[model samples]
Target chain A: MIERFQYDNRIVKNFLFVTIMWGVVGMLVGLTAAIQLVVPSWNFADWGSFGRLRPLHTNAVIFAFVGNAIFAGAYYSLQRLLKARMYSDMLGKIHFWGWQLIIVSAVITLPLGMTTGKEYAELEWPIDIAITLIWVVFGINMMGTIIKRRERHLYVAIWFYIATWVTVAMLHIVNSIELPISMTKSYSWYAGVQDALVQWWYGHNAVAFFLTTPFLGLMYYFLPKAANRPVYSYKLSIIHFWSLIFLYIWAGPHHLLYSALPEWAQSLGTVFSIMLIAPSWGGMLNGLLTLRGAWDRVREDPVLKFFVVAVTCYGMATLEGPLLSLKSINAIAHFTDWIIAHVHIGGIGWNGFMIFGMVYWLVPRMYGTKLHSVKLANAHFWLGTLGIILYAVPLYFAGFFQSLMWKQFTPDGFLMYPNFLGHTAGDQDGLRTARYRR
Target chain B: MDTLLEIKTAYVLRVIGGSVYLTGAFLMVYNVRKTVISGKLIANEDAEAPPLEKMDQAKESGHWHRWIERRPIQMLVISLIVVGIGGVLEIVPTFLVKTNIPTISSVKPYTPLELHGRDIYVREGCYTCHSQMVRPFRSETERYGEYAKAGEFVYDHPFQWGSKRTGPDLLRVGGKYPDSWHYYHMYDPTSMSPGSLMPPYMHMFEDLLDTTTTKRKIEAMRTMGVPYAADFPAHANDHLSAQQDKIVASLKKDGIEAQKEMEIIAVIAYLQRVGTDIKAKEVVEAKPANP
Candidate 1:
């Protein structure tokens, strides 16, 4: 018997709008923080200084910008893949507004100097609880839709979505175990080395499950649809999905390399991070190869162009991630501008472009019209491409220069560049050149 | 400080780059807006699909993987287990096992004043720019003193071994400067380190230390295995005020007037205490270095 239903495009639209809005806001904050590094006066008092605003910028970009994009792309794709409306419209509305509220709370509290002091997981106890609650709402809504899916076989994309949902939930609950001293203040349950391990475990997986996985899910869906092709290889998708999640969890310790984390755990992180290249590239290749015979279309269609660049960036960033995890490279690269450059490649080139591509593809179909202008989109593609190069390239050079200068010594066994500011000053020219080009 | 002038060109470029990115974002917004205006939203689109049929367990003789994929609950559980293995193996041993983080007997808990000051550090998000962990490299040791030990941070509730080093490592910053220097530096960074990018934390001088939470904080620390005496929370404030008074008197000796209750005094206490543990000869005889 045939079943007739409507796919909810309203929730997708709302999420997409939030994604674009937050993208602008988050990037603006990032640019401000960047400038604050060069001009200290821009840091206005305790409320608007680099110290507080940096977390605001990071949280906004990762959780607000990319996070909403994930939901927007996932909701649209998940519904179609499942062949069902969302299980509950109320739940969808609640999830959407609840997430926005959490972002708002972060904006208000983080700048006010209310924080738990964890790097990525910096939200105080109340906000953490709010995130957990909203996350559970999202999880229930997703699992409900999956259980009620009209399609018999779960798509590869759905599998990514499931892993993202479950893994993020687990990571959040485990890392957010803080004993609260007040409503807004709390101490981490894990102390010292144990705390470091736990925080990074959550931090690394936040990248893996939150940033990488869901975007991959979107790519798997949107890339194929835009190119009008099936995935390049079904078996490869299976291999890619499973191995990526399994390997990514152990790679957290690489963040603590050369720090006081246990040697065995550090080795585990390094070994697994190196091992992650296979599945990561597998997914990248699969996305790019989906457009194999459609090279002309890719050149003509701006959406496919965005996707092509995004997937290529994914490959480059993934390769770099593993290389940086190596002990020798990590010695120079860790805590330098190189790490910053590495993330932006994934952030702007991979995740940002993917969001652009997905949005361009979705808006037209959902609104029952052709795109506003292919030329403008192509222009965005170039400008954004230029922006990323301008942003990442100089920082990469700056990283090398900074690390070398920090390690340099005079022949008489004295520090060559004794002042830390000298190294920072060395990179300013390169950074200026890069940002100026953007 | 001469290099500070060179940073101006980079600042201009950052502005330009940011504007260019912003311009692209504006283009996207316009493009999306035009698309939205030209077309109507389909709040819901009609779709048709065959109803999912309940599969028979006996008849399901295909690949083993297909069985799990069809069941979302089972798949979620399995994924949790697979990911859990890594975190559990890495974290549980460090917590439960003794040798993972060997104790340094000289390492002791922060005094009530220093603990409050540490809270101020956390509050300001100083860890964003400065790292507390110094890797055991020749250059790092030469520049930042001794390499960091895991045992040194046992009392740190949320370890601030930060990832990035936008500023120099602060692990061994203790005893490196006078209290007046820290006071002036926190009041205005450029006064001490010329061309420093660090923001002036003038509010620390104006704000009084909120010792209201001292008891609760001490209790929380004790709960988290900090090894504070069971009776410590009851007298924590007395210890805090005593330390605060000493810091205030020392700052006065340096020709700087400061109140005993000022947040800067507490911050001074914390900074003077940081990374000074290993230098002590005996645990019972540990004393904070004078500025």
Candidate 2:
């Protein structure tokens, strides 16, 4: 018996292309939604309203853009790391096409108002089933490759990948259990408080495992390669991976704080969320320190600079996340533009920048040429940085403004801004208008 | 040598760093343009890293293998435990514990027409932005109304306990308006509340009421422990008709002629029932004073 390296780069390439395409689409949708906050007219009366388009933007970015990136990196790195070809190239293609199809269905249906009425887990049952099937296909291909690997032990990245797959599958299936009222309509099996708990549990971890962990896995792989250095601390990665996953699952309830969710769960969520800063920064530190000797390279290399900024942004977002989870802070942040600022900081600054860096590094290697224009790559970085700054700072101010106005009381004990619309119309209008122009 | 010295000088270093940063920034913008227009990568090459095996085989075996192999099962079990813990905490307190959700004697189930209206409200995803449950906090009670009690929602199959506060909570909407007022509000929200963000549901008025699903819905609710009569589906129509007459009379009082089968009437019926159940308790508590 002979071992051979027969991994399919084509699938990896397809996923990468889709990731970039959907990244742009998701970002544009996000930008549109952001603008709609300022210019409400842009939200036409029909399916394109803020309520409907908001979910579309989220689903496109998280599932279509980031999800594809996860698969792209996983397939590319997993094959070589395992020293084996994917279990089946056919399964890989099916998984790719199926995922893209699911994204397409989401794109169509969400705009058409076909939803389960759950945030993040809004896709109808048919598409939900498609997602489950495709996920299974992806899992089978992943597990088969692992089992048949020429190497015996799995690396830290593989552990993160395993956690990502298993946790996301559990999250998706559990949250999607609904009784169908129509082809595209369904009611959650667990209603009311139970439904809220289950949703944020799925929702928060969708951010955790789906968004954070897989990207952490990417960081583990790409950051080192870009810097021409080994990871600074293996022990830290171990601690970081486990603690992050376990703690991340429990922190979903923080999103529902001061609401109808039980007080104990809310407190539990807040505690774990606060604890998350340690492990999150540990991973960030590891990535940053990996470039300890390569800071000179970072000055010259566009790829390293992107990774540097991305890791720093991850650190900032992770730290801010814990702060925002606190009850007092969340009281002000929830349902405000502050939450918006926090999310985009993570999405555009951390995830977007890292993906850009990876594309810069990977595209050149894959195409067997030096970059056509380093100048262009540099330009994209600054514009993106500026866009992120322009996007987040005003929103943060707006969030505080909204929260203060909504909570403000006069000497007579009447609400300063008695109506919700008054709060929205105040500082938020300026922020929304600015975002719209962008 | 002097050129190297020039490059190493502070001004030269600053210029180099600045240009590199500028160049990197420019590349990002150009890349976006190129990506949009030609849809081409600046570079594409075959990946040169040794295939995955060489990397994997070089790692330490025993600890890593056990950790990786056990991860999936570990994550699944842990996630289940977390969910189960939260579930048990929520369910056990609500069900087994005697004092979990204090009962309010005045709280009663909705009338048949109101129940139908509540279902419509849910189907329209009103709770996506509006909450019906108010906690015993000053902010909530002041903003909405009296704090919500568990018994008020006893008959709710899936409680409309909304999460987001995109709109104000509707927990105490009962008696806030006349039957006709609700009709006009739902038809065109701006007419009732100026500067309202709520989308107009004029289509609800245009779309014929679907009574076909009423029986199945009742059956489903009954299965979910809603206290309904054994022959509730058989009497659903009679109950609906009687309730429709009352709503029509109320609407007529406000100079609005509403058909018995109109969706607006059903929605109005639901709106009127919201805080009414809790008001009954207050009336009972005040009965001693009257006597």
**Interface RMSD after interface superposition, each candidate:** 4.0, 12.7
After superposition, candidate 2 runs with Cα above 4 Å error: A423-438, B1-136, B148-166, B234-249, B257-267, B271-276
> What is the C-alpha lDDT profile of model 2 across A1-438, one tens digit per residue?
453344566787788878888976776676565445434456665577666777888899889988998998898788767777788989998999999999999999987777776777879889999999999999899988887676655667777787788878888998888777568766567655556677778888888888899999888888888888999988888788777876787788887787656677788889989999999999999999999878999988888888898999899999999998988888777766577678878887788788889877766555445666777676667766776676667667766765666676667776555545563323332233224324
Best model per lDDT? 1
In candidate 2, what are the lDDT values of residues B1-291, reduced to their tens digit? Answer: 121122123222222332333344345545644443444432222223343344345544545535544334454455455444543453445445545345556665566778778766755656556777676666557666787765565565456666555567788888866677778777766565554556677665776667776776666666665667899977887888888889889889878877888887889888888867878777888999999
* Candidate 1 clash pair list: A432-B10
Docking tier of model 1: it is medium
Give all TM-scores, in the order shown: 0.95, 0.84
> Best candidate per TM-score, number?
1
DockQ of each: 0.53, 0.13
What is the C-alpha lDDT profile of model 1 across B80-180, one tens digit per residue? 88888888888888888888888898899999999999999999999998999999999999888889888999999888888888778999989877787
Candidate 1 chain B, which ten residues in sequence have the lowest lDDT sum? Answer: B1-10
